[model samples]
Target: MARSTGAVGPSGCAATLTEPGAFGGSLGYAQKLSDDDPALPFTPGVDHGYLGVGLDVLGNCFGDWEHRGNGCETTSPAGTAFRIPAPGANMVTLRGPGDGTTGYCFLTATTSNFSTTGPWPSTLPGQLQGPTTSLPAGVTPAAVPSTYKFGFAASTGLFTDVHLIRNVSVHPAAALPQLNLVKQVSAASDVPLPLTPGQQVPYEYVVTNSGNTTLTDVNVTDDRVTGICCPGTTLTSGQTMTCTGTYTVTEADGLAGSVTNTALAHGTTPGGTMVDSPPSEVTLPVQRGPGLRLEKTVDEDRVYRAGDEVSYTYTVTNTGPTELTGIGVTDDRVDGITCQATTLAPGASTTCTGTYTVTQQDAERGNVINIAFARGQSGATTVESPPDTARVDVVTNRPALRIEKSVDDSRPYRVGERITYTYTVTNTGNTELSDVTVVDDRVTDVTCRATTLAPGASTTCTGTYTVTEADAVAGEITNVAVATADNGTVRSEPDQATVQVESKPCHGKDCHKPCHGKDCEPCADQRCEAY
Candidate 1:
């Protein structure tokens, strides 16, 4: 057998051999393109001593091949080669660019009118164009190659071997990274201060965040300590959410004080960022300080007579942390008044007293006397009682008197006859009379005998009646009487009386006159008529 090569150009016909055939016998191989090549026939035949074949590849046999003397004595090129007389059965193979170390991949091409410029290696099937491209899983062929080289279409050369041609290529891929943020948290500071009972005090809080990562949505929540709460809840960045809250103080054990106005401020970060600050925190402190108290004892209402003594009392205490100095109580209320007290200390107490007298003459009931108390220095600080007062009531003083007297208006008496009269005095006024005296005015014909009369008491006086011979004088004598009580009030009515005097007969003559109608006569009956 002899070997020869033949050549074919872009058109269908084979080119005539200009050089002589070097080897003997018809050594021919037809166009054996991959199944994807449009120029390769699905069903091939032999014509003009050239033959076609279809081949399936299991490995990279194309890169490793050699020629033997029985076929052609030729140095091998770096591609697949074969014998000139084609076998009854054959396989065609196609490939894409890849690494030899990793694995192998196959490509599929479409069958269509073979044109070099035709669309090939497309995503669709049946169109003819370029070389085969790699087919991933489930992919159909794109376009097929238009002109594939047939081995027989070569010149009859001494070293004749068919070379199979293929092509391959490669590229790479890309990526990106990620980012995140964290949160913050915080804790509280200290305790709070104390205030007087029923009094109020303001408290403060210091808040912060402590967590692992930077926080995104930062918010503050408040847990109100009963009876204590923040004036506002929301806070701006870096702004102190001051809780302007108050606590009303109440009495507790005097030794151990009570606590109030305790609250918590908690912070939160919204996103899932790592917490640079603590996840949870409290911003407020426990409150503590000295306690205070006040107590009063005296009742400002009282009554006392003029020149009478009145006393009042007061007590003060220190119920807190610090001591109280110069604690004092005073009442400069009424005239003739005085007050005093000393000092008080923390958790200690003291009492004081004051004395006063109602001295004014007209000081009446319900009059006010004021009193007050001080707590700091001797003369400086103090708190006063409401209506600051002491009430007073007083009594009255004066004297009064009344009197009566009786006397005889008419009297028949001798010239030296004795007579008596009496008088009485009484005190009907409210006050008792002291050092009282009574006096009687003497009559011209009568004489005064007794003098003093007690209040509601009586006294008598006597006068003398004389019968001196009244031969030359007329009939009778009259006299007047008068009396005075308290040496000032006088009582005497019609102050005089009539008196008669009759002389006894001297030398058998009648001296007493009886209702004298016509005087000095001797009455005689017919029998004893004598004149």
Candidate 2:
């Protein structure tokens, strides 16, 4: 039998056996031949043997061998033969069946054999004979041959053809570290459409380690804000961390119409190499100017009498992209209403109050209407609120009246004497009285200079009457008067005055004489000269 020899490469390398010869030379396998013949000569009376590979050294050959095929007429193994590289010392052993017994050969070489040159060691290191082995002081398993193969044959109870082989090389691991960062800005609260100054905005920085290596001492920072420190000092591959930052809006930000921020992340690799993530950025919009709105309301919508007090409330609001200052409120038809809040923030409101006394003119008009206005200043601009209006209805009250009548003359009145009667009308109710008239039952042509009387006001009307014979005969006269207002629909209670009428008494004796006929004679005496 013949086996081939070739270079021993690294672990995981493959070698093939076609026509057999001494296979792996690096594993110290040598062929023995009689007369240098190329082909194997089989004797019919002999039993052929199987060929196998082992990892061992000299007389200390150990472990089960990987059999390649049944021997004799050369059988081929499936796939390529391979060697598994371990953490420490490694060697090769060649085995074959010889005359009902097993024969072995061992070889040793340096762990790493990039180039094939070999005078294989005959004895295995004591370390290779044990269940576990450690490499020589200066050798590393990662740099060693990963695969090896050897072949040998036995015939007639004697071992013969042997060979060793190896395959390709493998390298050590590499170092790599990478980082990525992104930033975003958002409003902290319900902000007006346009951004406002003095508002708080939040910034977020997302840091990610996307490389195969772990990163240490990771830190994040923002251009617009400071003290943006990450939670963790280290980041692993495919892991992420978040950092926070904040900024207060400024006047310049508002004027520019927007605010911008940038963020960056940095970290160090295990190998002590520092790296930075790509810069990230975010932008927030600023609001334009201050806006104002006004609303007006009243405590009572309707008043039943003049001089009634009413309260008005005015609400002023700042509906703005920014804060408003020096806000003021005014009403076109009302007095004393104002704004309680001099400054207002976006989406904030405040109220103030005023009072008005219902006037007679207001009651006459039936309704009191008021309109309010609000104004504010934002930056250098002034803003006005939309007009708001409120209305109060006035109800009219009827006037009440009382009347008094009197006469200037005493109870006894002679015929043809003049008597004067007077009437007084007073308004006791809440409203004014107009078109007032006073009438006396005993006389005509009575008039008053004052025709209109206000609440709690009075008017005097006088008339004169001449006493008549009928009045004298009765010895008393009575007169009645009435006070009426507003076309006589309202009237005061009727009042009356009575006066007595009598003839003058006859003086001395003349007063006692009674003449029976017309034209009686004059008395001769002084007291009765007509007798």
Candidate 3:
């Protein structure tokens, strides 16, 4: 009954106790612990007394399971083996009955097999069974074992020790281990190339999954245009129905620039994000031009004689990518030239016609027989044929003419008598003058002249005269001129005048010759005398 201080009992690990037959049976206990640094649990003193002994429990009824000798025993009313002695003390002593007092003793056991019945689970010394072990991140521990022992002195029989094992303490926290995502590269497909400025070629792109987990809520975006109906818009997978999208290119200093885009795949991981594509390019060509040709011919060297028929022809051709519709040809070079049709196909040519009457009035020699041909759009500036002009000379075989006469009056003095006369001419022709000239020759108391004509641009010469008197005469007086330029006989056509003479008598005065007779003449006096 010396219960004055601290005491000891079995380790608090899972307990395995066996108290066989009531006559001082032995018990064993054991448990498991962690590998790093093993630890032993501390068992508490009895919560209450058992088997008529008001003492906390100690070790098994037997000594260490490795040996069967009398266990270094312990017996105290406190149910503890002994006082904890001091800071460095290890072993404790068990009490044996002093001869027939019917007292029991117990000693702790240590073996890999210590159990209540030699069949229960065991723990070697220095092992752990509770919260002393490390819990994984976000995790907790559970299901640890709890057990205790009982021993007593039988009042009417030999000393005996009995024990029962109970489950013991528990601890918990939280822990788990899975996959996550971090850095990644974007995915794209069918990126476009650049061409000219402000012109779009085509572009395409795709988004991919490159992370450790599934992703969700994916959306794509671009500043150049709308992403949904955009040109080159594409899912990472090539299985989408849309083949292409449209983007209008803009003006910039450089050939190209960058545009930011984003994507959101529907899921819980960073792998669900949309990715951008590489930039593309497009190219264009620039140019402009003209098309049509003209040519002309009008019976060569614009020369023709009277009654000659002139023909003009022009050729129009097309030399462009497009057809020359409504084409026309004009001949300002020549008059009376008419265009029949005015249309042409590429590389095609046609001819036009015109005629001129080279009449008798035409110039006989060199003339600028200018012939110009023009071709172009119907109402547009006409493209003239190169060297559109021609020159010509003409010769003619025709007739010619000359004038031949001069005249005044002089013969006799008379009151009302007439006299007539003539002059002649010649025919000048390589050919002859068919029907010669007929003269209208008469004198009203005056003289006159006449002639015959010639052929081949012919010429002639002649003279004229007149006479007068107071008496009447019947016979005519004639004067004639010869033809000088005509070949054989230079025929003379005569012109004539007639005169009448008479007398008047007076008495008591001498009668004198009168200036009014056939023979009467007035001399160079330029005057007439009276009878």
Superposed on all Cα atoms, the candidates' RMSDs to the truth, in angstroms, are 64.9, 52.3, 67.1
Compute the lDDT of residue 89 as modeled in candidate 1.
13
lDDT of model 1 at position 324:
51
Predicted model with the maximum TM-score: 2
Local accuracy by lDDT, each model? 0.32, 0.56, 0.31
Tens-digit lDDT track of model 1 for 122-185: 2222221223334336432222211122333222224444543345232222211111111111
Using TM-score, rank the candidates from best to worst: 2, 1, 3
Error of 3 at 221 (Å): 72
What would the TM-score be for candidate 1 when compared with the true structure? Answer: 0.25
Task: Tell me the TM-score of each prediction against the true structure.
Answer: 0.25, 0.30, 0.21
Model 3 alpha-carbon drift over 4 Å, by segment: 1-295, 299-311, 317-322, 331-337, 354-366, 378-384, 394-531
| Candidate 3: residue 242 lDDT (0-100) | 19
Cα RMSD for predicted model 1: 64.9
Question: lDDT: which candidate is best?
Answer: 2
Question: What are the per-residue Cα lDDT tens digits for candidate 3 across 406-457?
Answer: 3333443343533333333334332233333424343222212332343433
Between candidates 2 and 3, name the one with more favorable lDDT: 2
What is the lDDT for 409 in model 2? 54
The 10 consecutive residues of candidate 1 with the worst lDDT sum are: 67-76
